[model samples]
Target: MAREITGFSNPLVKRVRSLREKKLRKREGLFLAEGLRILTEARELGVLPEMIFLASGADPHPLASALINAVEAAGGDVIFTTPDILGKMSGKDNAQTLIGVYRDRLTPLPALDRARAPIWFVAQAMRDPGNLGTLMRIGDAVGAGGVILVDDCVDPFSVEAVRASMGAIFTQTIAHASWDEFLAWLRAGPGQLIGTSLNTDQDYQAPAYVPPAFLLIGNEARGLPAGYEAACDLLVKIPMLGRADSLNASVAGAVMAYEVLNQLRRTGDQGTAPQAPE
Candidate 1:
């Protein structure tokens, strides 16, 4: 049975709401993920929230009910609250009935199994949580190993990012490191680093992208620093036939990731050098 709470002044409610703050989240080592679909993905992915807040007397989603059972079975808490309290915690006037407080899953770069998948997505200094989240969604779509966040990127655990991910937050592995740290780690392994840039004349479609390829997109405003671009094993540019000078960082990343996924999927291609298999 779930505990029922009616007050907006509840301490646990405050704690769940505080996760919206980066400092509080870092201090707590937990983050907030909301919605039946997102929480369902988390449960299916073997991630159980430390606590779940459900609107009392509201009709429960079938999956949401399953989540509550799994959570309770795992010794997690389920709190039933008024809809207003749920709204207060989620900062949404029309908040979903279900919200979850999950442990942050960002891993260290060295902990990543680069060989776990054929492609991986990398982002540098991306400030927008929405863009960062969308890139993670793309990582999921391409069957990439994970999303490697380089440098001072947005917190992947932010509610905005998690919401933007539309549950891809649970589907994709996430890692973060500085440029130097990520580059050094990549160099120590068999991965290929492909960067998107305006300085490069090479076409995006022209490369025989290697398996375990790391597809990197630079910061939204300035893009990858000069030293970073020069460090890439190959740099390719998407042609802009329209008046737009460049693509949105996440959009560019999606285009690059799918192409890489296509290439690597065509053959168990591994380290094969040709663009296409005979």
Candidate 2:
């Protein structure tokens, strides 16, 4: 049985609402995920939220009901609340029927698997949560091993980023490191460090990306810091046909990431090579 929460001052409600603040979320080590799709994806990924809140009288879709039941079976609590209460917690106009409280899932830099062609997207000083989320989704879509956030980047756990990810946040592995730490890791690892730069005349497609490649992108505003290109095994640029100076960080990353996949696929490295003329 789901308990009914009617008051705005409820302790659990307050806690969930507080997650909107990065400081509070960091202190508590938990974040909120709103919407049925995200919650379902999280559940499918074996991520069990600490608590679940469903708006009373909201359409009880079969999947949502099943998720609620599963949570209760697993000793997790489920609360049915008014739409207003849910909206307050979700910080939205009309909140989704299901909102979940989940623990943060950031991981430390893992040992690069030199035996396989693993791709990693490295974002340096990325500040836009929406862009970061989109990048995460792109990373997940292209089967990248993980996303690495360098230095003081925007919080991926923030509501905007998580929501923009459209559930990729649950599936993708996210890592963090400082500039110095990343440099050290790059030297110690067997991966090729690839960077994007306008100064480079090389087309993005020119690189025959090796296994365990790290695609390093810079901040949205200023681009990569000075001398960073020296560390790259290869520097490539997406051709600018229009007047724009550069594509958005997320767009540039997606373009480069897909190219890497395309190269690998054509080369038959991952066993997805095109068929020969029959």
TM-score: which candidate is best? 1
After superposition, candidate 2 runs with Cα above 4 Å error: 110-117, 271-278
Write candidate 2's Cα lDDT for 1-278 as tens digits: 47899999999889899999999999999988888888999888788788999988757898898889888888888899988899999888776558988889888765544333367889999999999999988977877766889988999999999998888899777889888888887787677889999888999888799767789989999999867888789999899999988899999999998888777777756422123212
lDDT of 1 by residue, 1-278 (tens): 47999987888888898999999999999999988888888888899998999987867878988999999999999999988899999998956568999989988888898877777888899999999888888877777767998888889999999988888888778998988888889999898899998898999999898788888899999988989889989999999999987899989999998788677667566443223334
Best by lDDT: 1
Candidate 1 residue-wise lDDT at 215: 85
